[model samples]
Target: MSLLEVRGVTKEFVTRGEGAMARKSVFTAVDKVSFEVALGETLSIVGESGSGKSTTARIAARLLDPIGGSVVFDGQDVTRARGKDLARFRNNVQVVFQDPFSSLNPRYTVERIVTAPLTYQGITPKGGRQAYAQELMERVGLNPDHCRRYPAQFSGGQAQRIGIARALAVNPKLVICDEAVSALDVSIQAQVLELLMRLQRESGFSYVFIAHDLAVVRQISQRVAVMNRGRIVELGTRDQVFGAPRDEYTKTLLAAVPRINPEWDAKRRQKEAT
Candidate 1:
């Protein structure tokens, strides 16, 4: 039994007609997606844009109601949960959005941003909100003194750290990172990845790491699911999928990794070594 299980989940959106000629049609966003994330393990969904990876993530996190299938989190069916149940489900399964700037409120201070989830969940820690928020800030690589500053005051990476702190405020078991570090520079991306790895180790949290970058997903995921055109075409351990992908699409993606520093000697050496 995994901590999270998505069984045959499907989502479809009816694209409305526009103007006089635009016709109405249903767009299948996710199709029969089934997978599981064990406690303390990361499951990466890798795909290009418009691949329905984000849609699957949203369905799994209960942000969107699926048209079919089930999302069982910690043995509770989240697809049908409502009211207090929905709130609790949200607390347990938090999300860190791709854009750090847009995720945090520009007007609210960092401390307030982190503490908002706690108040929403009705959790008042023994040391109170201030102490708890400070602890969370430090945990996410932010200084407690900067808690008074607004989102605009921080760098892109720092704003993301604030987002991470906010996600952890409720002691969530699962974190759905929808392209979490994709918007940052290379150096900041590495730093944020390291921080996420550390958080998972300390909190025993599972991550649904969704990204188009195979390299990024490879760095953190234990298991990988390759999605295409609203369907999961391949699913396996990281080594299995990345090293010996059975699907032609997966192999094509692997083959497309850019080689900016191409060299005959290096190419030969790499091939021979492999």
Candidate 2:
């Protein structure tokens, strides 16, 4: 069985205009999207800004409720998990938001931020929370001595490392990276991606990576799901989706990626001809 499965998940938002004359309309953010992520794998959902890829990630993370369908993780239906069950489910799943600056609290020190999950779940680490948090910071490429520093003191990349460290503190089975590196500089983004891949190799954690960048998705994900208008237009292995996209939307998205080498098309053509 897959580690995580999202079956026919749907989400809608009701918007109502204020004042004397107002109209209510239901906006479908996600429509019957289904996919699965296996253990120690990365499943990336890529699309444009309003394509609902992030919404699907939110539902899978249990940060938002799905209006329809169910999310199953490790054979348990967690769509409506309650009380201790819900808390346990949350412990096994974690999220790293897009923006590090806003996702982390400016007032809290790095140690406190990384150990917050353990504190909330009432889990005391083997040695101590402070030591554990410092170890996590070092694992993510941050200075262990910087544990006493706040979010504002770190660079964007360093702040993101802190966020990643916090996500892994609970030793979650799955981590939802919602545009986790999109906000960083290109160089920094590559570093973060490498860090995530290395960490995954060591910890055996799966990722539901949500992003608008196709190139970034190609680098991190084993499987790719292309979303359009709140629906999945294509789903397949990275090679299958990138080399021979079956959906028109997927093709369009691939074509939009900027090429650093001007002869990239010629090289592709030559390689395909052979």
Candidate 3:
């Protein structure tokens, strides 16, 4: 069974009324989008800005309710889940935001930041929170001794590692990465992505990775879904999307990639010559 299913979801925002300027138009941010993610797999939602990629992630994470359609998790209808059920749903699906600096608490120590999720979930690990937090730190490539250090003391990569550690604190079954590594340097991004993959393998967690960079998504995702103007235009395996694009938009996007790769350059030159 699929781990998550977003069935024909639509999200619309209504313009607010103002003095002598009342407006009632609906801005369709997301339109009739549907997809599924299986357990222990990574599915990437790829799109440029304003393509509703983040909106889809928000819906899956239960941060926003869709105007039309349902969100199901692990065969349960989470679209209408309430109270403890809603809380449980939220706990099971965690998010790692785009900017680690903005996401992490400025004053809290790494220990507190990572352990906060466990405490908030009312989940006491086999050992104490401190022990769990330390283990998490070590797992994410941060020194356990640095748990007491504040976010200000950590670099961007380290801060993001802390964010990953915090997200794992609740033992989430699925993680929604909303451009989680977009702001990091290339090397740091690679390191963090590797860490995320490692953690997922060890913990058997699923991922809905949302990003604009197709190259980065190709590195970690088994399948890719392309969203354009509030709808998914194409969905396929990484090789299918990158190598055998079936949609014109997908082909155009692929054509725009820099011809720095030798094989790609040779193929393009051949095409041009022909």
Candidate 4:
């Protein structure tokens, strides 16, 4: 079953020109975009910068209210959910932002940060917040004892793990990762991606992964959506999109992805073996 569905969603921003009497114009960030994320599936939206992938992520998370279209989560319309309804929607869906440090509160200890979602939901964990937070820390491969430390004490990858732990605190049905590992080093990105896949296998929660890197999208997504100029140019399964692209934009994007020289890689591997 589809866990989250976004239909004909449109978002626009009104901007004014340089002078006081300058005219105002509307810039559409997202235009009639639609997609579905199935239960226990990873659906990635891939595009270059300013392609509205992040905007679509925010819309799916309900951080932005679209001027048009509807957002349905687990069969309930949540485009305009307010108060308790919104809170309930938040509990089921969590977001892991692009930057870990910026998303976390520096002043707060790791424990507080991880458990903040529960606190907001007014749902006290059975074993108390500290125990729950520590459990989450350990689950995400972080040291449970370091729960008392601040965000500044952790490395970039570690901090992102803390963010992941926070997202899992609510036992969300879907997790929206908005360029979640793009800021990390390539090796660290691989580690984080592995962790995410492992967690999904264990928890059976879906993922709406938004990224610009086609390589990263290939690793995690079962399905792919290519967006350009605020619209989805192509949507298909991983193999269909990567192996036989139908859209010109999609083909261009695929061609742009950097690939290592196979012959050079083989020679290096042989040398290492000797």
RMSD of each: 4.2, 3.6, 5.1, 4.2
Taking all chains together, the TM-score of candidate 4 against the true structure is: 0.94
lDDT of 3 by residue, 47-116 (tens): 8899999999999888999989999999999997888899899788989998998999898888889988
For model 2, the local distance difference test gives 0.93
Candidate 2 residue lDDT tens string, 137-157: 889988899999999999999
Ranked candidates, highest TM-score first: 4, 2, 1, 3
TM-score of 3: 0.91
Better candidate number, 1 or 2, judged by lDDT: 2
Model 3: lDDT to the true structure: 0.89
Each model's total of backbone clashes: 0, 0, 0, 0
Which sections of candidate 1 miss by over 4 Å?
Answer: 259-274
Residue 66, model 4: lDDT of: 98
Which TM-score value belongs to model 2?
Answer: 0.94
Candidate 4 worst ten-residue window by lDDT: 264-273
Candidate 3 wrong stretches, greater than 4 Å: 16-24, 259-274
Candidates in order, TM-scores: namely 0.93, 0.94, 0.91, 0.94
lDDT of each: 0.91, 0.93, 0.89, 0.96
